[model samples]
Target: MCGILAVFGCSDNSQAKRARIVELSRRLRHRGPDWSGLHCHEDCYLAHQRLAIVDPASGDQPLYNQDKTVVVTVNGEIYNHKELRAQLKSHTFRTGSDCEVIAHLYEEHGENFVGMLDGMFSFVLLDTRDKSFIAARDAIGITPLYIGWGLDEMKALSDDCERFTYLLPGHIYSSKQGGLRRWYNPTWYSEQIPSTPYDPLVLRGAFEKAVIKRLMTDVPFGVLLSGGLDSSLVAAVASRHLADAEAACQWGSQLHTFCIGLKGSPDTKAAREVADYLGTRHHEFHFTIQEGIDALEEAPNKEEFHQETCQKIKALHLYDCLRANKSTSAWGVEARVPFLDKEFINIAMSIDPEWKMIRPDLGRIEKWILRNAFDDEKNPYLPKHILYRQKEQFSDGVGYSWIDGLKDHANKQVTDSMLMNASFVYPENTPTTKEAYYYRTIFEKFFPKNAARSTVPGGPSVACSTAKAVEWDASWSKNLDPSGRAALGVHAAAYEETGNTEAANLMNGSPQKRLEMLDENCNSCLIEDIVASASCGWHMFVALWEKLLTTKEGNWLHKQNEIVPYKFVFLFSKTFLKGNIKYL
Candidate 1:
């Protein structure tokens, strides 16, 4: 979640509007391919694209505060920034950014310091003495902001931004109060119904402090296992508090997790049985469904229940918080969801929506209050048949023959008069199957206008529910099949289980014998990096012959090389092949 673009009152503030805001923040350079920031003030433009999770060397962003008169740029993560830098001990933090305490909490609580931030953000500050400004977004937007009125609305991000919108998720936009406000009002945003109660140790201590405040992070993070049950209770409470994380002193205390699937799937056998019961170092990728439709024609880029999970967590920014923040920031990776933390969704949505429904007359199944709050019977965070494992969905947990190979390759490339003129060729969210009109013709060949097809989210959903919960089942509005094996019979009761048998013969082997065992493990790691770079160039040529025998013409060439005993005849080279010439 690191790609921001801010522009205020610009009537073209020069050097071609800072080279058109560095060419519209290079269309969010795949959500931050490591770095790129821009702050310019004269007409207010605060761009940033940095994905350096927490202090990647001085935390690069638009930040700045001390006598620099407040400025910010942020995208997300501020997990109580070391308790807001111990309440800004008289403010002077120019970076170790958990977003440099939002320009010293807006110069010590100004526009009410965006509700004293916590985690998941979408900033934009700037003050520079009274030239005032603001922008906010987290209480659940989870990170993504978007507001345009110029650059002609921001053609999807900015081809001369003609007009843009999305900036409302616990809002706040000021510029001296000229508009937006709603800065996150909780108490379960009032639609009545919560009665608190259900305290399995206060909902397992607010989901283990929302998965240990998203493990704060200085980098190397993981856990996206679709072993389900909210990513296997976020990888069993981050592999049980990953050795007391400071990102386990530089990515260690062994918790890696991942998953992706389809070769003996059910989310790679329940994420390799919860990464072999939480010892985690898992990985597992596997692909194939025409490599997920050629990685979706090659390019970057779920659920409801319980007040339909608070209207799908307030429409998760707009679909799983914009596909988990632009599909893991397209790959620069930074996904922290801890069930979309925000004070563990206000203490699991202030409980008592009948103990989150699905009763089955008392053996309450669905999330059974988060599997009876980590049902830990003496250090057991999982393994009660994987905490009563049930929901899979992520396209049938990766396999059900991958949505029947994307509906038999979109019914052999969408014909039958293109599904009867798919509402006159996508008359806004049209695609009613043929795998959603072959992924809306690869998203209209990369966003063909109409405000990028009215920002996507179309109708009907089945296993991925909501078209009013697909009218709460009448054969789910006639089977839309969004894939938990189209209405979950628990994917054929965990589709013939199968995990071991050498991981089912290495996931049903032979894709040209796994590309000849990955080209024999890349020629055995390129011959062990060419024999450790020829033993580090023969130990830097014996430390340059012992620093030329400690100089003075190498002490007369080391006393004529110890009285001419130097037959250094190591010269065999017909590209030194057969047993690599070792005459010593």
Candidate 2:
């Protein structure tokens, strides 16, 4: 997890361009707050912000191939890196990090690097001597990338969409082919569909393999269990793997899961239930609607579309909070969302839209697909009701009131008179709601220049499908809300019950019946934090003293895994004695 900003094909003042790229990548400080690095040559500049997911002590970006022939900056996990490393054993290798495989693969088959790995990654590899850079985004674009051009610095790379490129994943770049090459193709995606009832076991195996492959990072890792099927399944599989490895070997890796939501949010409850069911160490952050909204407002997305900004804000908070907790390094955890994995997605997306929409035995969106694909009576982690819960838009999952708040904020910012002139002034994506206008106004303020903002593809869809898909439904035009909450007719009964404002949660059952479960886990987690922080503040220091006094169980704080940052904060804080040191 990191940020890379590359300026290639630029003409003059290479140092000047390097400075700009450094500033631009710094904009992603929230993504990779731990370390920063830069690589510069005559025509190319690459700047990286590092989040040490793999090889925390040694691995940092602007990584180079043996002898420094190839250099790259990567921003996502590579799950099959070790396997790829084994395959490319003939090449000299360095670093325990999963991403080191890219440099080696590039050395073996310059542009074939994408064919060898399975993970979500966006990267730019620079060949200084060749005066070129390779760029690519993952197959599903699960990890975001954008390309824009102020002007071409070199002979316009012919047929290249722009001198500034957003590389598509599963493809490699060269100063050679000049662009991306797609490497993923399965039977489902092709024209021949000899549907033999879509073998459930095959789908199941593919998913398990996908999950395993995505587990490649060298750092501590855990699942973000929302207690929903997707998240729970990931957590369950991960926990099972860690347990098996530990029992078989003398030791194994640790998994520490994390979940966050507004106090009393449906997600908080589900995540905790799933965590306990999996029997994994878990960290829960229960925020208020105001906290989530405030985080969104203060987040440094630079993008102005409120929906897009909100997405960036949430991702930013997740990364930052994880850093604060030191969960990644403490537990050697590298996070992956199997639900977002491309191989899994291809199977999930290929079903005829009708079958995909059916509520399996458990009346929920995607439940049938997951149940059928996993061949499970029920996922062990999710409560049967939550596993089969209805369609809740990703945005709404954060908080029901967040969308309403954003809309209200937008409304107050843009007047009816201003909306009337939108078409004349902006013409493209002119503000429909005041919320949108408020976002656009912010966007215009930050990105007063046209090129930077246009890089983010935008238009309209009931949900987040490509803008072209808008033609499939006329309601898309009638509604401006980008959250899935906009699609009430398509969602399950819960959506219908909410009059389409939000999905009705069913951690146990309908909102009316299971209101208790909906608010239970998170409220308890909040109560726990207050108590634990207070206890750790005083008792933990006393424990630290016990450790200095003797080597007994009472001194477990010293013997139990101690990372420098955690211990320093603890001992240092005792010197000041204000707050408790929170740790695993």
On TM-score, the candidate that comes out on top is 2
What candidate 2 gets wrong by more than 4 Å, as runs, is 9-28, 148-165, 168-171, 179-196, 245-255, 299-335, 346-366, 375-381, 465-477, 486-584
Per-residue CA lDDT of model 2 for 521-567, tens digit only, reads 22222222112121111122122222232433223323332351112
Looking at candidate 2, what is the lDDT of residue 366?
44
State how far residue 193 of model 2 sits from its true place (Å): 5.2
lDDT of 1 by residue, 1-584 (tens): 56777777888798987887787776666556677888787888787877776777788888888887788888888788889789779877877878888888778878887787877788778797877888888887866676773211123263455546677789888878888989888876755557778888887888777787787766555665767666677678777887997768865787766565666876678779878988877656565544444333330001234455566566656655554455445444566766666676688787766666666778987668778888878988878887777665565566655555556655767788988988997788787777667656655544565665565566776544457766766655788655535654534554443343432443322121211101222222122112211111111122223333354533432342242221010101101110110000
Per-model C-alpha lDDT, please? 0.61, 0.49
Per-model TM-score, in order, reads: 0.31, 0.69
| RMSD (CA, angstroms), candidate 1 | 28.9
Q: Against the true structure, whose lDDT is highest?
A: 1
Please list the residue runs of candidate 1 whose C-alpha ends up more than 4 Å from where it truly belongs after superposition: 1-4, 8-41, 45-68, 92-100, 105-156, 161-210, 215-230, 235-322, 326-335, 338-378, 384-393, 398-402, 412-437, 445-584
